[model samples]
Target: HEAPSPEEHLQARTSPLRIEPPFCQQTDDFAHNSTLHGISHIFPYERGWIKRCLWVVFFLGSLTFLLFVCVDRIHFYLEYQHVTQLDEISTPAMVFPAVTFCNLNSFRFSRVTRNDLYHAGELLALLNQRYEIRDIHLVEDNVLEALKIKADFHNFKPRPFNMREFYDRTGHDIKDMLLACHFRGTECRPEDFQVVFTRYGKCYTFNAGNEGHTPLITTKGGMGNGLELMLDIQQDEYLPVWGETDETSFEAGIKVQIHSQEEPSFIDQLGFGVAPGFQTFVSCQEQRLIYLPPPWGDCKVTPMDSEFFESYGISACRIDCETRYLVENCNCRMVHMPGDAPYCTPELYKECADPALDFLVERDNDFCVCEMPCNMTRYSKELSFVKIPSKASAKYLAKKYNKSEQYIAENILVLDIFFEALNYETIEQKKAYEVAGLLGDIGGHMGLFIGASILTILELFDYIYEVIFPFSHVVYIGRNHYSKERGQYFTSLRKNCLLICSHIYQMLAL
Candidate 1:
């Protein structure tokens, strides 16, 4: 054939059909630093098929492991984030003690004009005119107004209840009235100590102290009321009625139950209601009040001045202490009328209420600073009625209505008055879940179930970094340059082989 031109020769060498091994090629410096060369150091790409398959398996497994970690992390965040959020968000526990005062039986009265004996049901309707006792309709319509009567009959109607009508409707069943008399006279006077009144006086001048009604704990119900009588008595105030007795005993002939309606818990039991719960007391044929076991024996309570805080509220002892602090410091009292300081006029009270209230707020911020007085007496009452002849001999009646019978029939009414305290629920902070323990549990479960560890995560990140960052070391030579190198190698090999065979043939011919 004619000698091929340089261009034609170059084309023939560079053709795809050329036969040559890759090692025979002369490569540039850039080619030596190519991607395949760098990848070979990290992973042997030229290995047998079995090794290649294994490498692919390892790569895919690592990717799956990373995916598992991602999923686990997402789950952990979703699950444990609530603990952090719960730690930040809190609400005051509904642990305030609730006192429910419901009358068990209505009073019976004799009619003066008609000589008729009255029924309890009739008395309930008439009492509704003076004070809402049984009309569930009125109570439901104006619960706040109805509850106020339980606290104090301050808004009683101007017209007195028709005594004749009252007597005609309830024949000598005066227990409900007696309850009203107790609450009405909760703001007691010195004369109240002399005798339990058949009626409460309408006087604003008496400052007998909270010697009437001071419950350490109170609830939404205020004091309960019903068609039955409500016996309202303070253990301290009714000491005379109980006679010279350090301790007294009587049957609480009515059902006693706590209305807290809270989830049962140690924290709830501490401040929510009475411990061991409440039960019913019965009196069969007795009609008198007596004392019971020494109340909250040996329990410590912060002593409060009953007279000093009579007007503000029944449980105004904390404010009383704060007011006392202000008086000692500023030499004045605030807006609390009937407080300890007689000199605190309206003008002085106006000036001091804000500052005093602020200081009280700050003082109460201290942990357990205004805790329930451990020693203060709490009051509760059991009311019941029985029909015994007015002229029945005391001994014969006592024998007939004996103590055990009195309990079932609830003739000997016993009132249990105690100071409900906050010894248990003073601490406000409670955890919905412990955060640290949850994290540990998740981590432990992951290790046990999936053989995963924190080290596995670090290794996954390392593999990703190696794969992406090593690209910086790789060099790219164009496809044309590689093809040209291969072509030159094959062409030279053919030429050299031809020269060698020609020399060997000449020697054989000689």
Candidate 2:
């Protein structure tokens, strides 16, 4: 063989060699046919353009309908609703066991004026006596710090009452007043405020000129002692206890009014995630002295069973039980507990408190030791002010009392509270399957009209899964082993041959 000439080499360099791509080239007829075959495996029923369009429409419509059904009926069945009418029936019984002064500003009467201090001091004394509060240590800064540290009845959240306005209207420094009453000073000594009671021989008197007396603070729907008050609420009536004041004198005269309501059908007393059915609406809408159905009675829950309560009166009792248990076991009382319980310092708590306290720290449920108190009705209250005249004014004395003026000009602030049956509804909250039932009903409708069942959903998912992941070729156990790269090609060839032979056999038979 002779070497190629320079002219041949120049020709080779100038004229580029043209090489065809693999058999699956984009424009090739065989490539197109193979693609159609693969597509046919995915969609066996799809044929022409019109058939493909119809299939697309069918798929979109079916998807839209399925989503609509799930969104509508599934959410509807998650929570239950029961109607309540406020006439000719007894309302649920509620109790008001205790009250909390929520705002730090409400305790600053000493800084405001001497009269404010005197009145607030006397009121603080009365409150300590009534509630048996051990200390009036108002958390001035980061009030929630203690609440964050300890789990107790005081932190039982989502309280039905709105105290924002109560504190806003009074704006009395309650902690200062307690200090004035207990320490007879401007503020309490950090060490002196051990128990919040009137000091021996220290009785503060409020002499608000004869025209006015220190705003007589009282409550209804709460158990009363001496000048204290509570309401005898019954069926069909929600008690709103508010303070009536002389708008002219700015005196607070708290009153309790009984209003009628239609009978309430308890939708769910399982109070875990469920709200106080009617109470939430009544308060949120500020619908005092008016009878109305719960506005949200027909509304569907976005996230079902969402309402919750962190603590209850029974929870307090359980803490007392736990305290008793501690006293029995370790001979020390926890400082966080209410009543005349002795304070358990940090060292004491560490030395004496059970390891169970650590266990129960952030848990949602109450004590496992003590069961809920039966026959005890629980109440929560909202304080609202209405303009009215002091009943102590002269309209009734000329007529003997000022009933008309009292009705019109007196500042009447009401504490509206409704009662509910108390029990452990946390863990035991039963789900109301409204949506599931609706789905079942839909299934029945399909069966009656279109011969379909919920199993159709399973079938649809299975079809989609098969399309995404088609079955692989069946290999004979003793066949030759092949590398992964060549195995796929060999399987495709075998499958194509089988299809062709089957087609030919059918053609021959025909």
Query: What is the Cα-based lDDT of residue 341 in candidate 1?
Result: 65
| Tens-digit lDDT track of model 1 for 363-480 | 5565224433332222233433334323344355446544233332234333333222212212122233345655666566545444446665565465555544433322232244
Pick the TM-score winner: 1
Q: TM-score of predicted model 2?
A: 0.25
Q: Residue 380, candidate 1: how far off, in angstroms? A: 17
TM-score of each: 0.27, 0.25
Output the lDDT of residue 166, model 1.
Answer: 41
> Candidate 2, after superposition: displacement of residue 148 in Å?
49
TM-score, cand. 1 = 0.27
lDDT of 2 by residue, 294-407 (tens): 232322222211112223333444455555556666666543333454544333444455344544443625643433332223223343333222456336422522224333
Candidate 2 local Cα displacement, residue 425, angstroms: 18
Runs of candidate 1 with Cα error greater than 4 angstroms are 1-49, 55-101, 106-410, 414-510
- Each prediction's RMSD over C-alphas, in Å, is 20.7, 22.5
Off by over 4 Å in 2: 1-59, 71-311, 314-435, 441-451, 458-510
After TM-score superposition, what is the CA distance of residue 208 in candidate 2 from its true location, in Å?
35
